[model samples]
Target: MRLWLAIIVGKICAFASRFFKRGGGSSLPGSLARRIEPHILIRLLEKATPALTSVIITGSNGKTTTARMVAEVLKHSGLRIVWNRSGANMVNGIISALIEKCSIRGRLCADVAVLEVDEANLRHVVADIKPGVILVTNCFRDQLDRYGEVDTTLALIRMALKDAPPGSTLLLNADDPLVASLASGSRCKTMFYGIESLDLTSGYTQDRNTVTDMNANMNMGMNTNMDASDMNASNINASEYLPHDARSCPNCGAYYEYSLITYGHLGKYRCPRCLSSRPAPDFPALNVVAQGAHGFTFAVGFEHDSEYDSIGASLGLPGLYNVYNCLAAIACCLLLGIPKMIIEEGIAKSSSAFGRMETIQIGDRSVLLALVKNPVGFNEVIRTIASEGSNKTLIVCLNDNFADGRDVSWVWDVDMERLSRNPSFIRSIVASGTRAEDIALRLKYAGINQEKICIEPDLDRALELGLRKLAPGETLYVLPTYTAMLEIREHVRRRSHVREFWRA
Candidate 1:
């Protein structure tokens, strides 16, 4: 009786959400439905199926993008999938997605479920929906106010995996040391994917410096001796540093040696003391090509030679970080028996998931909104901008909202100095939002000319001022934290002639 009532109420809320755009019901009706009757909702869905195959993608950055890719790949394989395209990763969002798709008879119609869940909410969602496969993209410091540190976020994922069903596959980023470390001692089959191309540089000097520090800290903590070979392998070559080597053994306080460093100590590494290194990958990415904004080119590495053999594919998103994301998604999809052609087609046609790399046209100019809440994410955004050949303007908005964390100190860690070097390409810098002054000061300290920097606390005024400076045929790159992105989106929506198309 309660279950029926909950489903009926959920339908009402889902209907209401359509009208009340401001309320979360429209965006996250599942969360509200779960709150109203948790057992009823779960029971209602469970009654329809005895077993389920579910795939969950979680990480600090790229969860939405990876989730979208995974869903696309699965769809290409002819499996019906229910996914949350919105940037909703919480429990309510998951519930809402389910509610939106489920029939009034309470049966889940999809063949599989691919969800991009929040790192913090993984444990809650996993307990309620023990998925068949879990893909962990990478762990970085994000939402410091909500998640104290990267390790805390990692710990949550570890807990969630513990609840996963047996025979479940764990797809992870072998390039990210933190993610690789979590796969240790897992009972599930683990598959890893990362960049194997040696031609790609680690990035700017600041990026190299940060990687060195992370490696050194990892080495020091493990009391490992860094031999000459290790040093040579870890040193930066062609602007980017070496592939990430394991710094320490997660089981023991012993230094790990690395055969290569992918990015920020995320390559193949083995603890000399414990003899533990990255387990051999069941699937890896090969024949890589970094396609700037058009996406990536690579072949999926698999363990078996079946009719659906490995084939090349292209992604539709921008930036190198997304290449890593695509690899992670491909790894999981391969494990699920998704054919190579489908995976390629899905990636080639797929777009970013919401603000990950959403582009909007404001008046005559194009505004690319990239979300940067952490050092790694911000660094990637900076690198993407530097790689673009055209002269562009940057509007960086920082906020200390509860979601963004009060500690704006991470700004210093971000290599804002890179933007300073390419002054000619940067037409102007507009620093705005609650932390507008802080962003301006950081840019100034990084060597951006004071004459070109503008600080506007009011977003509307800032957008107006920033857009005025952009010449015709030029695009404005707007990078903001979470809250700032929402506000910016709202502001963009207010413009009468502009149309906002949410990324899938």
Candidate 2:
């Protein structure tokens, strides 16, 4: 009776939310449903068990995009999918999604359910979902105010893994040391995905300093027989001096040493004392055959593959981060026994999920929506913007709401100086959101032209300012925090007559 009542009430709330135009109300309905029946999600999953393949994508970054890619791959294989696509990653939000898709009788109609779950909500979700496949993208210092430190975030994921079904497949990022560490204690079967080398530098654009740091690290690590072509270390513009999440080895407590340092703390790491190192990837991008404006050409070799396969896929998105996202999705598809050709085709056809480099047109100008929630993510966005040579304007929105992380100090950690490195790369900078001044001041400190820095706390006004500055052929990069991304994307969607993501 409680389960039925919860479902009925949740359905009504969902309907009323859309009717009253009070936003999606994704969590409210689920929250109410949970209150009525504490174990509603578990009960719902039980009803779908044995038939539905539950998959959860969790980590500090790339959850949404990776989940979307998994859905697309599964869909291409002719599997029906029910997923939470609206950036709602919490337990209630996920429950809300299930309520909308599953029959009110509490039975699933789809072959699979792909959920992008929040890191903090891991234990709660795992108790209910017990996903057959869990993909941990990468762990970074994100939402420090909420998670405290990198280890805390990692610990949350480790805890969640406890609830995943035994013998479940864990597709992890081998490049991320922290992400890879989850495999150590797993009762689950684990496969890893990572890149070996690249033909070009990482991010939207390459700063000389970033490139220098990467090459220096690569050169440092090149001392061994590890093939440079196999490592492709020079292809990324990684910062060695930046605050790394893994400074020392978790196993040995020795200074974390690296043979190759990819973007952030991801790369070939080894602890001298314990002989700990990056495990050999099950699926490794052995060589970057080519890197162009279109997409990446990777020589991918699976541990079990007869030989390396060179696949060239064009990206509808930008940034090196997307390249990593592609690798992660391909790994997931491969594990599900999706045919190699199908995986390749699906990745090539994949679009940027929602606001992560989601582009929309506001009149004649193109607005590129990129979500940046942490310094690591934001720095990559800046690099991407710098990659575009000229005729680009930026509108960055920073919100200090609880959802966006109460502490706004992470903005300072973003190396905004990359934006000003190429004078023609950015023409105007508009800072918006509740903390518009803070973001604007951060940019000014990064060396963007003081006169070019504009501020409008109002979303509508900010949109107007940003669009007015763009030329007919130029692009405006709209970078926003979690909450801000949704708000800004909605505003752009309305003006551009595009479907809201939930509707899309």
Candidate 1 segments exceeding 4 Å error: 23-28, 49-51, 201-247, 254-259, 272-275, 292-294, 305-309, 496-504
RMSD of 2: 5.2
Model 2 spans > 4 angstroms off: 201-204, 207-241, 303-314
lDDT of each: 0.71, 0.78
Question: lDDT value for candidate 1?
Answer: 0.71
Candidate 2 per-residue C-alpha lDDT over 235-298 given as tens digits, one digit per residue, 9 for 90 to 100: 4222433546776778877766665655677777777788878888877886553354445566
The window of 10 residues in a row where model 1 has the poorest summed lDDT is 236-245
TM-score, one value per model: 0.86, 0.90
Give me candidate 2's TM-score against the actual structure.
Answer: 0.90
lDDT of 1 by residue, 341-444 (tens): 77778787777766777778876777888898877778778877787564668899998887678888778767676676656866788999899999999988
The local distance difference test score of model 2 is 0.78
